[model samples]
Target: MKLQDHSASLSEVNQSVDTTVVHKSGWRKILAFFGPAYLVSVGYMDPGNWATDLAGGSKYGYTLLWVLLMSNLMALLLQSLSARLGIVRGRDLAQANRETYPAPVNFVLYILAEIAIAATDLAEVLGMAIGIQLLTGLPLMWGVGLTVLDTFLLLLLQRYGIRKMEAFIITLVAIVGISFFVELVLARPPMGEVVTGFIPSLPDDTALYIAIGIIGATVMPHNLYLHSALVQTRKIKKTNEGIRHALKINFLDTTIALNLAFFVNAAILILAATVFYKAGHTEIADLHEAHRMLEPLLGTRLAPILFAVALIAAGQSSTVTGTLAGQIVMEGYLRLRINPWLRRLITRLVAIIPALIVIWVSGEEKIGQLLVFSQVLLSLQLGFAVIPLIHFVSDKHTMGAFAIKPIVKAGAWLISTVLVYLNIRMVWSEASEFISGNNPWWIDGLIILVGLAFISLLVITIIYPWLSRYRMERSARMHPTKVTLGSLEAPSYKRIAMALDFSQNDEKIIANALAQGRPDTEYILIHIVESASARYFGKEADDFETRKDQEQLDTYLALLAGRNINAKGVLGYRHRAKEIVRIVKAHDADLLVLGGHGHKGIKDWIYGETVNYVRHYVHIPVLVVQ
Candidate 1:
């Protein structure tokens, strides 16, 4: 089996682009490797990071700048490992885990990965909403509702192609960088204090808590999944020399992009330290309050405007990448593919629902706390992703000649150990406070039960490699079934069923089906007029839609006629999947052929389940050509 053939589809964006440096040299060669790191960098300066930076700077002045610096260094190291894993192994982190671990272990890791993505999305959603609330006088809940529209933005940009989308993301990152640069200049932070802030120090428990949040938000788990896949989008030769060149260029890309992210994060903390901490307004932790106070503190309108603009840009860029990460995780771990738009909607809604509830019930007062807690949740899930990445990239069996050197391996392990320790300490502190504080007995019991379960799962994950090895050995000894030559010599397909949505992809579907068609084989083309949309309008509207659908089907039939293929078009109203299955059964189709657009995220949940349903209901061999 070819492992490269099973690479996640998310990396197919720019797969055709040649990243080899045949004639190119210096900066020009480096430019080809620029995109993936910027995409990863978006997570570093997202709203969750913003909330922590603001809280740290305001409450403790520039004391926590060392944490930001430390976190960025860790991010730089981890992100490099992630990219190397993809480039060397031709597999994303999630896919690697799925292939390496046992079913039960993989399932637990999948759950943790999804939770990390959701937590990351929650921060983005809240940040965008708060940015909107700052620029306009809208309520927090309304602003959150508006964020759903970003799904449409992603859909629009994606249609233009991956290069275009990368350019757009780069522009957003530029906006954020320039916005913070201007703010940094306006704030004019003390050079002496800023330099001193770089020295490591933690004043108290609050500082430690916020410091952990910074690390969690900065070294995002999804970015590890995302970067690994994103690196594969560029075409690199599989030779040892080509791999080394690519790794070097990628290291440069990671360093440059993450330093830029560091500047943005540092500027946020410095701005807070200068304006709020110096003025004795150290309690300005809320995003809205930070935005509102900026104008008065700087005594200029551009200060606040720039602040809000940067905030929105950060949030928007992160959410776009966040959506892609969600799709990669789902496809990588579950081997389940859905429409990209639907996948985006599902993940966005998952994040948005919780945010909307918090806004409506607890109000914006709780948002700051919620953002911090979300990062902490991300911190909890970080080990599951990071540990596996380190293990794979360092393993000679997996990486071959490209496996990490001993020095690099030692540093990576050290970073992972520090992160794991921080996360455990944060959880322990939170649990201690919860148990000590006044609360209901049931609530305390619930906390204890949840903590126990988490510990149990952690233990299982630790021992999973041994379990996987045992299972592999046991399975290796089992006998396999064999097929006879007569069965292999049967006819390819007697009858085939094709489903069409009458979209631009319909022709592609028809072309693919024709490729499989024989003179004796029959083909049934299907179109379903959805009942819900028909009911939204009246019978006249439904009739009009049916007429349009029929016209499109006729064009398909005409194409089939020209090819001299035995084919007929079938139309039905109301249910799509059931109708397609019924037509397939009625025609006695030996094979079902359909066009898969690979719609995912939010769109998958809403209307992209048709193919899934057909696959489950139909007993025949199904050929889904994407």
Candidate 2:
């Protein structure tokens, strides 16, 4: 088998894509569609939601419960639409946006989406750190610093497959759910009053502001990008029936997952209402204060303990999904893929640095404000994501028969309008407060300029689809004949290089390398000596491993010589991929043959991904044999 580069969405986990949902029926089939939504659902109840829900319930005493319900309903509809785009169109929100819009537009969209993810991650880092501080009595700064370690935890879980990662998230969700369930039991909130809280009434401006915050924070912008891509992980049939079945099952999955998220959010609000508002602690907003007051008001130590545990669970789960969203947006919009660890580390650090700076400069009292600011950042991007999603799923050319009906489209539009309006109101309120407190004229002017630019982008995004449709129709009528191109023949190899491990695969590598060469073509046998001394001394190292590698290369060259082949031996020290690439370039070889060790998952981490490094760095045709 020959290896080649594949630019699949979430290419690191491409092995899991389209491999789990094949040839199953009933519950087994339904289970395959269950995971993606769970991943998306975690975003709905992330640390960002905690601040808003806690604030609403404490300040308004369950009067804003209706907002959570309304937000949940909107999330279900929007998320289902997102999944339909993936199952029917095989494109994520980011990928669809890239294809639909111009390059500059997509670049801005990509940056906005990335900023939204970083903001979401900032909330998670703060929440997780606070939870650790609450539970272990550790300093908040240490807790914030320690949150960086979970990036490796994410890397480790990913090795097992998507199902394993899903299981881990589900476990965390359960912890949050069960923790709140116990808290509600302890608080014993009045059932009649709690039900009355959902009657859709805002008593004052404070209530309205909190209501806007609840709605704005509930529908995460990144989750829209994430759900559309995640549903493509399963392989379904190509027929209408297959698409329909996949859509139906995925809707069920989305409903269940998001409703569970609703329960978590509602429970947080209810717990806050019952414990804080009932005791006249209406100003409670900070998570640390909430946890501290829980023990005293609920009259049980367990209440505070469960609260801390649930917060940690929520933070951890949200961080995983946030990193995935970052990856999807970066790859989908930019077509750039990097090392997964490096990507995760970059995201975590982006969030972590801000968090640590806040902790060090302003202290833990400011974390709640930071969390709210992150939600505001998300609010700024919500319209940019939701409007495009609606346009894509409603487009007949892209969705075909899977295009949403007129009524569904109307409802999606109405929901998008309401969400965008409320988020704008919230963002404006936050911005006004900041501007009022600020001192510099340039800073205010910059904010105004950015706001105007944002509106311009939003306008262009809304109208571009119709404009693009018209342009296509006009072009098709004017130019009936389609453009065509001719294919070229394969090139002949003049010089080939075989990178050897001096193992059982050397002979196989030689055979494949020889097969690609012409009769008069020259070949170079290459190997790298990576011993302890060789790493320090380069080619001057005199070590047993170096001598052994040299002898192995000589034996391979002699074997090729006996076959009347034009071959020479070349050996280098230090890094495997770097040495192979350098030696191949120095010898002026046009082709490089490498043996695939079939390393994957943890083995890939241990042995290093040399083939990728060599292929990416060298400007030649690479043939990887397995």
Candidate 3:
């Protein structure tokens, strides 16, 4: 229920760090706000961005540079809003949505956010693996396996403190920047053409698709969650002046960091443009192709080496933050906690399995396409994160005096609308193309069905808030003054049933049931024998199993009688869950008490769990005593 309880531990790690600088007004004080944005900027220039930028530049020769610039501008605005939300409201985007939205809305948003994170991680994992493959001679699968171990090593650095981790990330970012800068100089792109490329232009449909990829890869969804939470790590005072100052300083940090990301992205495009496109190597859309061609085209081996090093740096850095984002999303949305290592492993495996499959089946050539597809998937889930962010920040109630300016709110809405439109357009374009391809009729039908389903989900996501508001208003109007029982009375269970497995834990279950039941309560002790004889013999097996269970039930009844508990016993032949539900309903029982061994792992799965089944089938509340 508390804010901290739902916030990610990564953000909580260095929370309230150095809060005593409110009176200071120098650049030294502003330095305290620099780390979070750099951490976020890593997402902007990750290896996924590399694939898109490389493709855009080599294939179209800087014509799609406008897309990267536009996406960065969008990133800057959204990330600033994300940081403002955390600073002004003291809640991350996930926590804000969780507190503001209804359960169903929150549940849907949580699912979308998770999908976005997984998609983001999918790109990061592949990027890191490809970087590994490029740097070393290892297979792509081996490189992916290596990434899992390397990520754990990087995460262990967090134990040194968040600042150290931030410093490490900045160091990697610097490496990427310097590597690209060096490549830019070696490639020697024409300034006039580069400037022309900056002007917004799309040559054709292929350019539009690649431009969308650039946007998707640049303005990531997970970074929004990550930045919002990361800003909370700082210790700013909870005052209007303090918040205003924090926002201004954080904006500067975001601007500087993201511009650096822009430079890195642009440098990637410029390198590809000058080195590949100008040299008539228009087919160099793939990262590996670009890497191989850089050496021969640029007439220097260092270019490819620097490219690979920068890639590995970008991939490694992004992987660390990707893991952090996974943890943040999981904890924020689901309010569930697992060991950080375990959570990372689960997410990594989810990504790794598919990456390995693609590598094995499709080979290394498909990695670039997979990376681009992952980014587009992130784009699909972007609206779910973006709309809620704009809504929360624009609302007077949520933001109070710190609510976004009218112009800013309008701009945010414009951006959200554009993103939503682009996503729908992309989906339609892709679906139409697929349907028109050489696929079978049934496959076309399936594609159409999936597109309709996706559109339906999008419509629901957009309209859920309105539906919730209307439902609440309708309920209020219909109910008027709701009546309630305000008495502190214990609930009575007149007809109670206890399920016994005849285990050693049965006594504890019986004791617990007695503790809750009144003296006059009727308790039915039931046990079902899952007799193997029922498969081989019919009536004889049923009678034999019934008699055996009856003796056990009689013994339980005698035990209950000795304790002065009014009770009866029943025995059934097979189908434990069915018989238990039948007895509960037949007796009109209010509650069911069951003995639970709390079995786990394989044994729990294979032997089945009776209490779970009964709880699902019956309306009565079933309590399991472990």
Candidate 4:
């Protein structure tokens, strides 16, 4: 198959051609592969991580810094694998899952991925609002409301292209890194104790809970999906040598970006350990409380200001990635595309409504707890994404020589097993606590019911890949003979309808329609007048532009007459696609031919998507002439 026949990863912004044409070596070549991991890395040190790192640091006094280190390493490996899958197989994690699993299974997986994204966005909404409130003294509710406007900001950025968007994300990341670097300087954390904190130890169940949250916040599930799709944004050569080169360069990108993210996260925990724990205030879990204490404890007003600025930067950057992941999951699993703004609005609403209610019911004090819980919820969804990714990249038939080695496959499974065990343990601990408390009996029953459902889904995710592989192997053995195709029938059209915009494409559309028609076929020439007067008056309007449109249709009719073709002209006003569809049905045409304008991105917005609307609503075989 030709390359263009294959489906594009992100059709709107798929600019691999640009990268393919620009042949650069050395550092310039490496720079082309750098932006994707930076976008993926923002999810690591988002506002969600701030809540978990702060809780871990203030309560256990840096005992859980080891969790941060471990999670970062895992993230590095998994993200590299994700990039390899996209580069080798030309499929994202979600698309790979869709191709491998049954329809019902893919639907469930898509929902889970979306839930993880919403959970991530929930933390971002709260974190950004809190930061806004801290820095500008705006009400938290007002700040939450203002975040809805960010949808437009994202839309504006998208118009500029992905590289520009990546540049914007990198700038935010720089703001966050620089802010934390200054804060670590001001707090002056003890180097000796900080080094010892790297030794692994979980103090209690609470520490375990925070540690799980830390893992979830650091090694995000959505980032896996995002990274796979993001890597495809570059146009690399399809040869094995080219794939190997891309993989090597991408590993360097992932390592550098994630380590910077690690620094931002570790700095948060270390600063919290020094400023909050060493001062005898161990329960400084709330971000608001932490910010309030920063000035007096560190004896510098600049400390809290920098804290708020970094918080805002992290939230904004992470939210952009979260929405982008949502887009990838929906398109990959369902093969459906909607307006980007609509998707953003739906995701923001899902996160915002819950946040608004939580604040309204329990007040802002619960924001820290909510953020931590969201991260843990994200952790719970990790296995669904990670398992499928491992299965795809490890498949020898699919990945060929690019398949992961046995040792690497074993390492991936080990990580998966550790994540699964931790998640189970955390659920059990939380369930035990809830049941032992004075909570209602139904609440306990509900918890058990949800736990059973979650286990069933996870088990299906784990075993489906192996089961699928076994079934394929068995079928191959049964059908040993090579299959051959039979001849097919050709279709002939009796009545053909051609829609014209009175542009140069009208000739191409008419010629294609003639090629599909029989000698006795009748032709219906259609056009829609989009002038203002015709829109109001419809068929009765005798305006100058409408008359010229009618004249154009007559001109086409005269041309068809020279060939002794059965032809008639029909003109309608108002909505273009709607009128064309109506006229085509009225004429009972077997095939409809329309010209393609090739509009995309912001142009699709400006010039309404007429071709898409007509093709979808019309039942006839529609031919698009380019």
Candidate 5:
């Protein structure tokens, strides 16, 4: 019994060790795999989300948390579809849609999506600048000035691979996540109220308005587009098991980061609720009020400072996502290649103009109104962007093996419809502030300018397709078949040579079939001995050789085995250079072709005997194929 007991105890100890090993290994796996999705999460936590959450919690307390849960699930389903499309096709979302849709429809959808990305980007810039003001006590204008510093940040992104950028953003996300985690615990938000918020009860008119803001904020279109495009940056191959893993990793990544986002969003709402709900705080505005009011409630130094730090992180990280999204939108839609720096500068300048103007003219009194307005526009534009993602992902011609199932399509459509309905409701509510206000002179002036700007931008966004089609038609009429890239090839050689280490005739057959321009060119086969004497000695003779001789033999054999081309090689040395020149002279050879790495410089040419002898002595037109 004692021996048996010892054995059982040892077995238990072994089991415990095995469990410990598994736990450690699992943690390593999780960390190693935790990329891509966190990058996607940045868009979810963009300044737009913070502004919406601030508005929601301040106005309705815990009444609209349900909007976030539903919106995030919707975001996940849509982004996943886009990501799956990318994985299967190995092309970004915009390009795939362009190929799949009719030219007119594709042009329209591309322009609308690009505008949506730009609008989303504008939110990121404003949010980052706001966070800068909160964190550094800079004036709003100076904080906006610091947005230019993002150009430097973009430099770091290019110098280091995007993996480094992902890490930097993930750290920022962790800081934001931890700040909210602490704030949520300290605020001691009512569990019962939080639960009820998710139950979807009808609120008063104020509650419904706040609810719309929350939904709009949570469901930005660019996040779907960014996630879908970003997944292709990783080394996801187009194999079945590999694709399945990519999908799984994307989901896990999105879930982890978005779950943190959900908490961060809820924390902002809960903080606002705890500090300002129904306290007769009718006109509290700006991140300043958010901080100062919360200071008295959640202690002084940590909570408010953390709030600012989180805002800064959210805004800065989002700028990177916004920049990349802008690049994709331009490349995929406009087919115009501009410097990334120029693109970012243009976006920042335009986006910050409104926010800067708001802070200047209306002061903090209207920032709340501005956040709601921006978010509602974002919600409205998202449908235009997301509906096509669903359509493209479901199209059998496009997605092929990875076409979204019927149920997923149904869910995506339902989500898009609900969001469209919410945006319409929100836009109607927001339009009232500009149109129906009691103020007289400045109100009318502000209303006219803002309305014109809003309508003009919206009209441009909607009518871009017609404009694009007109331009395309006009351009086609003006020019025809403008050849692109390397069209200056001489007539395809009747005979071609492929240099081989161990290649077979299979490639020669294909290359021969694929040879362009001249199909009936004479094919010549030739092999060279190391020296003219080697032809008499056979393969097993004395191998005293010259540089030109060795080169001629290899080049000749390759030319023989490769594509059908009229070319041959000969064996000779000492006068070998003279001999090859003599052969070219004798055959009246039109061209000599040599295969190589992309190097044709004097450095590679002079060091190797074959290249050295062939290049230096031969006078015929020599073509180098890389």
Candidate 6:
């Protein structure tokens, strides 16, 4: 017993030590990690950050540059943890947290994540309107009306590849970079103040809040989720050398993007200090103000033009990353495979409608303030999300070979504590000031309920670490859903509808499943050319099959089988594997016998669908008959 305990303790200690060296830090090869790093960087350059950065600089000038500098470095360090988690542990934060966390913790993370995405969408809409106003000389209202075009463009872009969309994003970043650079040079006031801006300090009701906003805007919670998952897409070899190279390139890409962001962030502040503060403009309450203000001083009518174009670029780029990140978060954590376009539409619609409503009721200035208010709420959401990321990444089990060092962990905790404190204090101050100054009893109720709920959640989040083992054991005790082959008794399922596309041996395998019959099992031999189904039917063929194809499919399967037959040849463009799962589950089949003839070319199997979508949605015992 003593020896076993000692061994267990040593094993745990070994595990703890291993995570430090987990990333296997090397850099001779950095090309592999570029794609995901670029995608992740979009979040850094998102329009929300621009809203805050622009506001920060215009409101407080170079004073808040420190925050931008600090936060970018912070984001770089934290985001690197995400990349290491994927490369070393072979799981993104979502997948890792799903396994490492309890039900309650996982649920909290998911809810916060979804909320963050929604909040970010709010700014993207504003950015879009700003862009339209820049390009076409339309009102914010009309500009917003036109942003639906962005969604259509996004959908069309997807037909090519995610990389093409990424390229477009780089173009946006470049435009943003150049625009900011020109503004910085044009507004050049004092080289000394700009240099001093890099040094951190607390500067009154001015840049301080805006600086925090810049920090908040940059290290978005969703991008962390997005980055972790995106790394797997590159198909990097699991070897240490390959993994190190991937990390190096990822660091390079992220560093480049974020460093650019730092400059732009600084530029915004420097320009604001030089142009707005020196000019004695007390208010820069909206995007229009900033634009109009620039026109008079820059001595160019193109000032508003540059402003709107930058806003549009920032808006569109962020929207893509937001959609992709949301997709990653949902799909990774909840196993919910939502369509990207539809998902993007939902977020876009949600963002657009509220802006339209606000514009219809109030005006551009009010709407823009509302966007800031939404961002404040986002600050709260982001506060909660950061805690878990910090907690999980610092854990030995989760980190495997890349756990944070003690100094780093301490610093992270300190930053997190201050963030939470600021958020709570701000919330209380806002609720009290708003409620006492002008609001009613419902505000009281809302404050009480929300505060209590947050407290309850915090308590649960704290206590969860202790209860996890017990809860895990309890979960383990529950019986799994009964999934058995040869259980569904049917006389007519011998008619096989084979989901056939990428499987050449599909016929051979279907024949084998027919020949190697489970006496009690009902067999639905299905050859589903889903693409063909869609082509011929001109609509989705859900076991909603055409009679001729069904009859012909039934006859073909009936020719090979020895039992009851009810086969259908359905055509649809749905994923073939998922289609099979849905069909088998809907019919309550005893067995889903897929034909894995394995006769396809290597390239075909690699590029095409072999296991179908089984890895994503299948829960039953799949019989891939040879």
Which numbered prediction scores highest in TM-score against the true structure?
2
Greater-TM-score candidate between 2 and 5: 2
lDDT accuracy of residue 554 in candidate 2: 80
User: Candidate 6 at 196: error in angstroms?
Assistant: 2.1
CA lDDT of every candidate:
0.85, 0.85, 0.80, 0.88, 0.63, 0.65
Per-prediction TM-score to the true structure, in the order listed: 0.83, 0.93, 0.73, 0.87, 0.66, 0.74
TM-score-better candidate, 3 vs 6? 6
Which tens-of-lDDT digit does each residue in 14-97 have in candidate 3? 364664465766766888777999999999888888888888888999788888888899999999999998788666777766
Residue 160 error, candidate 6, Å: 4.1
lDDT of 5 at 580: 48
Q: Cα RMSD (Å) between model 3 and the true structure? A: 9.9
Q: lDDT winner among the candidates?
A: 4
Which regions of candidate 2 deviate over 4 angstroms?
1-7, 14-23, 427-444, 470-490
Error of 5 at 447 (Å): 13
Q: Model 5: residues >4 Å from true position, as ranges?
A: 1-33, 101-108, 278-285, 428-626
- Candidates in descending TM-score order: 2, 4, 1, 6, 3, 5
RMSD (Cα, Å) for all candidates, in order, is 5.6, 3.5, 9.9, 4.2, 16.1, 8.9
After superposition, which runs of candidate 4 have C-alpha atoms over 4 Å from their true positions?
Answer: 1-8, 11-22, 101-105, 298-301, 438-442, 467-498, 502-523, 542-548, 551-567, 590-603, 620-626
Higher-lDDT candidate of 5 and 6: 6
Angstrom error of the Cα, residue 253, model 6: value is 3.0
Ranking 1 against 3 by TM-score, winner: 1
In the range 405-507, model 2's lDDT, one tens digit per residue, is 9999999999888866766666577668778975699898887787778778988988998787623322211334676665766778888999888788888
